[model samples]
Target: MKSSEVTSLSPPPFSQVLSMPTSNQGWPEDFGFQLGGTGPSYILSVEEGSSAHLAGLQAGDQVLEIEGHNVSTLGPQAVIAIAQTQKNIPPSIGVVSRIQQV
Candidate 1:
């Protein structure tokens, strides 16, 4: 899909949201862009000050995988799994997403 046509998908369902962190990175003048990338099933938002943010995730970057695990296929279920089990995701964790200029 064209980048403009690719609407940013909503976060994983609310039930699974709590499993992920709640920290909010400061609001940017314009949030960076992310196009629901691929890999394992887990995807997450990096809170402004949280470690995830420092690693480079913007508001819409998709957590396509952790280590080598696939995240795009598992969807919300996979995200919960990562949030619950992994605490120190690498800075490269979100590279799979096909982010675009906003």
Candidate 2:
């Protein structure tokens, strides 16, 4: 079977929205999640007990949108830049959670 056929046979990824509020300092790190990826930025890690962790963000979650901006085709830096633009308000992050198949 082709790679496309194999991919099609797998279940589709599910999406979830995370409302993460930044700290008073308003920095990307304050959001408690590390982002990494070139195209389609993804969450590298979620700090324990942090806003992102509480908001249900997990490592490997593919970022679909950030603060209402589509980031599906953006690099990590661009995505982080968009995230940094938000101040005290909680930014709505759209993510696709992929489940690893055994």
Candidate 3:
């Protein structure tokens, strides 16, 4: 997907918001989405019914922010750090997607 038609993902189509728990003994820990690349990453894929899937994430979505930090301003390490912090929260990050047009 190209960034030309990028748009913010809000009030997602499914209306199923999700978050990560701080800790769990046997939660299996599946956020359901595979975020690949180092900086300016894209979601390579999203598992069905996973938190990522429920929260409206999908393949080809461009991750725009995490927590509240812009991915562009922060380097890959910083972005990774922000993502790490969200391990215990819901809506871990904000992402832009071309799929919105669909």
Candidate 4:
């Protein structure tokens, strides 16, 4: 998919904000979740009982923003870098959960 593309239909997608408190290192890995994809990064996995899972982040959920910064044009690595450098104690992440319709 292109950097501007999101896996969704018309009427927009279901988006939510999750406030996740990170460890002293301030890394997503510390929150027990991994990110994947180039631009418009998505959650690769979420560990059970971890902060990410408790925050409602699920695998396949596309990351829309990090700490209010639009990240749809950024790659996964860039997003991770932003997360690591953010000064926010508990960063607010905006994400869109892609629900598969059977």
lDDT of 1 by residue, 2-102 (tens): 55656688867643222233321211211222222244332245456444554566654555655555655555444444534553422125444545778
TM-score to native of every candidate shown: 0.42, 0.68, 0.58, 0.72
| TM-score quality measure for candidate 2 | 0.68
Tens-digit per-residue lDDT, 1-102, candidate 2: 655534447667746554554343354477777888889788889888777888899998999987778899998888877876765355778999864857
Models, CA RMSD each? 16.3, 13.0, 13.0, 14.6
Which residues of candidate 4, in runs, are more than 4 Å off? 1-26
C-alpha RMSD of candidate 3: 13.0
Clashing pairs for predicted structure model 4, backbone only: none
Score candidate 1 by TM-score against the native. Answer: 0.42
Q: Candidate 2 or 4, higher lDDT?
A: 4
Q: lDDT order of candidates, best first? A: 4, 2, 3, 1
Per-prediction tally of clashes? 13, 0, 1, 0
lDDT of 4 by residue, 1-101 (tens): 65775696578663655446544265677787888888879899998877789889999999999899999778888988887777775467899997586
Alpha carbon lDDT at 55, candidate 3: 74
Indicate the residue-level lDDT of 94 in model 2: 91
Q: In angstroms, how far off is 1's CA in candidate 1? A: 64
Tell me how candidate 3 scores on lDDT.
0.64
Model 3 misplaced stretches (Cα beyond 4 Å): 1-20, 23-29, 73-78, 86-88, 99-102
